[model samples]
Target chain A: MSFDGLWPYIYIAIAGWLATDLWRWAGVVAGNRIDERSEVLNWVRAVATALVAAVIAKLIVFPTGTLEASPLWLRLGAVAFGGLCFFIGGRFRQIAGIAAAIAFLAAGLALLGV
Target chain B: MTAPPESQSQSHWFLLGMRGIFSLPAIILMLSFVGFAAFTAEAKVPVEQVMFMTGMVWALPAKVILVGSMLSGAHIATAFLAVTLSSVRMMPMVAALIPEIRDRRTPTWLLLIVSHFVAITAWVFAMEKVRDVPRGGRVAFFAGFGVTLTLTNIVLVGLVYGAVSEFPPIVSGCLFFLTPVYFLTSIWISARHRVIYWALGIGLALGTIFAVVAPEYDILLAGVVGGTAAWWGERALRRREAAR
Candidate 1:
């Protein structure tokens, strides 16, 4: 409620987002004529994809927020269930499976009072 | 390939879908930030400042470090340094995207504006689809995409701040589940190379192990070790293939 209390979050948000913008600008500036299929783009795609993957894995394995409280088995089950759904539903159906896995896990946890 | 005017329309819609889905993710991601702000608000971290940073910094990890360091009583300089260390990942990200945007001479002004909201999520989606857009149209598409996400995130933060209790830990936990679920799905759907499969295995193994041992540097350490191992593994595979 206090103005003083609000400032830190604001500062963090601005600085964090802006620092990243610097690169997008650089990409636009430098991307003037490069081929998308070239080795560089492929590496970028691979690494970026890899990082996003790593982030997802980290969250499942060591979640911070609400997830931190959920039992480890539930988290792993949700991921594995989601993985199964992903494989079963094909590409688009996988999104729903993710939601379902989480929902199921959460419901089970709630029922068990864990 | 130049995206024809009509294809551009379709692609625009596609980008819009990508942007809109971010709202769903933002609904969850913002909760942690809002919760952190609300929890720490009495301690002097600005809510507006946090909201503004969420918009400006767009990247969650850096934003967390910047404010977390400051909250810990670290000076702005230290906060900046820590955030910058995390920002190092963006260098390789930029190196990869620049060449893809080649061919279109987007005006300097628009690039400046679009750059502000470019985050890992948008970059991944854009990289996949940018090739379909001609060099010139990429900016507009990216602009439209970035703007959509920026507006959504701001609204999301505001909502999270206002409705903090509605999304209790259970809801928050469920929401947080989206990141991993989404990424895992994307990898399963798109990964083609054996190298990628190996990289993922190594990254997950090392990342999980190191995460427990050294929570602070897990991502960076896993990335470096796993990435290098994957690279070498692929090289070795290629050599064997050639020899055969």
Candidate 2:
């Protein structure tokens, strides 16, 4: 890549650093002053939890790349099957559940001949 | 239960922490990073730049967004905005986690440095394991775990980037699936509050609905609206219980 092409990486590094690290530094400073049970902390936790969920949902619902080629039913089915495996394996078997989902997706793809 | 004596040296505590993450947690994180390495290779990002991002950026989702947006011809500012918005979730995680491992005597500079290590994997592992370490040892423990994770990523990303050409697209795609699936499973496993469960379910539904109807801002909208709904629902339930 040329020098101009490299400019984008530098920009991404600086901009991405500011975007993410600002929160971490702010949290460290503010964490020193706040009690865990404070309402503000609770709200922050709520928002964070929801944001992570939203990210996961977006991945499943609006995935990019080859995963996006699968039908919606297949995608949703993989998640549901994974959830079921999670529960059936006594809820602590996370890797097992994920493996099951992967297996389901592979098998479904094969059966569909897609 | 009796508290463990807080007499361990910082190095000792750090070694213990390293040992703790040397197992399943580290394996999971390594696999995730390898997946990300494959992803960067597929995106045609340079190996050196990928390593730089892995070291500096650290957060997978933001890194993914940065690469995805930039590859799609997004302007630098637009890519930055997308990555930043996606990563706003880490703030609460850091806020909640630092308090658990910190004390009045903890150095502000140290706290600032360690905060960079407070990603989802480290945070979850630390929350579960830090309680067992003595008070003074907690920070060292987290630092060790965090540093190990980073080093592992650096090494694995290098290896995967070189070998990515040998893997089929389907194999690489399945590996990519591990990232989001792992996040989803971890959240479900770690969440102790019923309200958070409600938030996740509602968020998933709303995210899907919005992705179809308004794909551009689906995640942001789902997070704000679904989280607010879950918070309100939990508060109402708490009030009813108190009244009863």
Candidate 3:
């Protein structure tokens, strides 16, 4: 591959590594120094939690690839069903919720013959 | 708080951690990685590249953001920023998790290395279980769990890459949904603060609106605006409660 072709991987290596690893290194340095209950840390936690929530929201609302083929209503219904199963499954809710969502999507697709 | 009992042996604790990862949590993790594998395949990313991303990045959200951004012909710097922003959550996770397994005697280098494995799966597990492990055994336990997860993800991604061609379209489509569903549910189960609830509600609303308004920067926009709103709302509520 040309250097142009290889640029993405290089970017992935440097940028990707820094993005995730910086936090890890910082956490190590700050291990016990920063109290978990501190205002700054709590704010950081809120932002981080919000970021992940935004990611999930973006995926559901503005998905790419095959997921884009399904109608918005179907996707929302799937998530709702999955969240319900998550609450009901008790112990292994992650798997249960995901399974329910996929099953709901499959059944919906089949019914519509999509 | 009282000290936990001394571990039977570090090796025994390590083994316990290794065994502990074989349960539902690990299964969910494996399935999610499998979904990622299928996603990369559909995106036409090379298998070797996918493996490299998994090993190095290790965070699914960052990986997804990187792959999606690059494929859309985004500049390298822009892609990097998106990935980094998406991954900022790991800072708090690593910060929170390391203390549970750390003691003064624990080497800084070791903590740094172990921190690499502190993804959501390992972090949640370590936070809940490490308290029961002896202080000296905590590192070993986390190492065992983290290492197993890393290796398993690497292997699972490779297998799924090779196998994606055989799966029917619906199956692969469903697999692609697994990662997002897993993340949302994990967040739901782990949410302990009212701020988290506000953030989720606001993020969903803003993210949905922004996706149509500005597709390229929706995640970042929603995160900053929704997160800040939630933080302020939480503080206001706390102040009112204290005044009462």
TM-scores (chain A) of the candidates: 0.73, 0.82, 0.72
Q: Which sequence of candidate numbers ranks them by DockQ, best first?
A: 2, 3, 1
Give residue B139's error in model 2 in angstroms.
2.3
Native contacts conserved, per model: 0.43, 0.58, 0.60
lDDT of each: 0.62, 0.76, 0.76
Summarize candidate 1's per-residue lDDT along A1-114 as a digit string, tens digits. 233655555445444554566655665555544466665444444555455556667777877756666678888887777767766775456566767687777886687665
lDDT-best of 1 and 2? 2
Per-candidate Cα RMSD to the true structure, in Å, reads 4.5, 3.1, 4.0
Against the native chain B, what TM-score does each candidate's chain B reach?
A: 0.76, 0.85, 0.76
lDDT of 3 by residue, A1-114 (tens): 222467657877976877779878886776557565676555555665666676678777666666777788998999999889988888877778888998999888777766
What digit string (tens of lDDT, one per residue) describes model 2 on residues B76-124?
A: 7787788877676677778777777987799989999999887767876
TM-score of each: 0.79, 0.88, 0.81
Q: Report the C-alpha lDDT of model 2 over A1-114, residue by residue, as the tens digit.
A: 232467866866775766778878887877777776676665556666676677777777777766777787887788789878988878358877888877877777677655
Best by DockQ: 2
User: By summed lDDT, which 10 consecutive residues of candidate 1 chain B come out lowest?
Assistant: B23-32
